[model samples]
Target: MKIYEITFSPTGGTKKVADSLSNELGRDITGVDLSDNNEDLHEFSLKNEDIAIIAVPSYSGRVPATAAERISRIQGNGAKAIIVCVYGNRAYEDTLVELQDIVQKNGFLVVAAVAAIAEHSIAHKYAKDRPDKDDNRLLKEFAAKINEKLKKKDFSTPEIPGNRPYRKAGNAGIVPKPTKACTQCGLCASRCPVGAIDKNNPAKVNRKACISCMRCVSVCPHQARKINGLLLAIVNMMLKKACSIRKECELYI
Candidate 1:
């Protein structure tokens, strides 16, 4: 059976967790990056025999709207799906359940769910260097168990947690802008998930369209993209208490 690693990870932390899970889940695992802004988001359909491990980082406790919108376009065609929601150490409140709902609506059979933690995308100090050795061991164990479940023909939908009307997603939190050091190389513009950065002049940013996923900040080769230092300091203070404590990955089958 083919395993599809479908994820929307902007800053790479969530992708790392999804990669570890996919690597152990099976051989011939294919990747479908939900972050690719240039792709035609709606072109794939999975066979019933296929398994899709759909993962997305929690954006303010919900699936990022861009991710949810792009992901909704793919037709699952009754494929078995192991839905995963990766979040910073803070919290994933409704992300996993919300994502499972989406894949199911797209015709996937929900077999299992995982809520995992990675480093904070915006404020890197939290859950730093995650999906480390111990995290990989746990992820592999989860993969093994999921494999065992797949062996059985039964495909009952698993119960996932969340409310019918998810909590409101917060406003764009940390929009990054290119610094004077920016060379208008367009890498950040090309890579912005929502096309928030101006293509011709890479330093120009449209904050209204920005999701603040930090792709520009993380992808900049010259480290020219950045958030306001004062804002970052405030965010650090706001999240410090919620992020300092270690959190473990949770699985629901």
Candidate 2:
């Protein structure tokens, strides 16, 4: 069966986890990158014979609003899906459940769910070097289990973590800005999904449209983009208290 790897990763943490899991599956995987700056969304038409691994990062215990909207456009066509939610060290909360509902609504039957931990995008201090060696091993083991289950034709749904009503959505975190090193090349502006930045000037950012996903910062070749120092410090302190050091990855099928 063809394997589709769909992901929305801004800072690369979620992409790392998704790639590792796809590699372990030892299949030719088709990737759908949701990080494109353009407004175009993927239009998938999965057959019943295909399998899909859909991965997305948790934004404040919820799916990225833009990413979720894009994913809803996919036509699963009754394909069996494996839903993966990658989160910073804090918590995934209702992300998995919400993702499941979305995927199901898109005509995919979820046969598996994964909650994986990766380095925090904004609060880098928490989960500093994660989806590390241990995380990879766990992912491999999870893939093996999935392979076995598919071989047995088992399609039972597994219990996924998250609350019913979901925790209240949190406020948008810190927004990034171009540093003095920026050349005003307009790359960040052209690559901003929400068109928050002005193409003519990299320094201009419409805060209302910026989602704080750090895409512009991570994509900047000059390393010129950064969030406010004071804001980062405050976020780090809050996350440090909320996230534990010994976080683990989980799989359900």
Q: Pick the candidate with the highest lDDT.
A: 1
Q: TM-score of model 2 relative to the true fold?
A: 0.95
Error of 1 at 75 (Å): 0.5
- Put down candidate 1 lDDT per residue, 63-120, tens digits, no spaces: 9999999989999999999999998889998888899888889999999898888888
* lDDT tens digits by residue: candidate 2, 127-206: 88999999999999998898888889887778887887877776575678887899988778877767888888788778
Model 2, residue 176: distance off in Å is 0.8
> Which residue pairs in model 1 clash with each other?
none
lDDT of 1: 0.87
lDDT of each: 0.87, 0.85
Residue 146, model 2, lDDT: 89
| Clashing pairs counted in every model | 0, 0
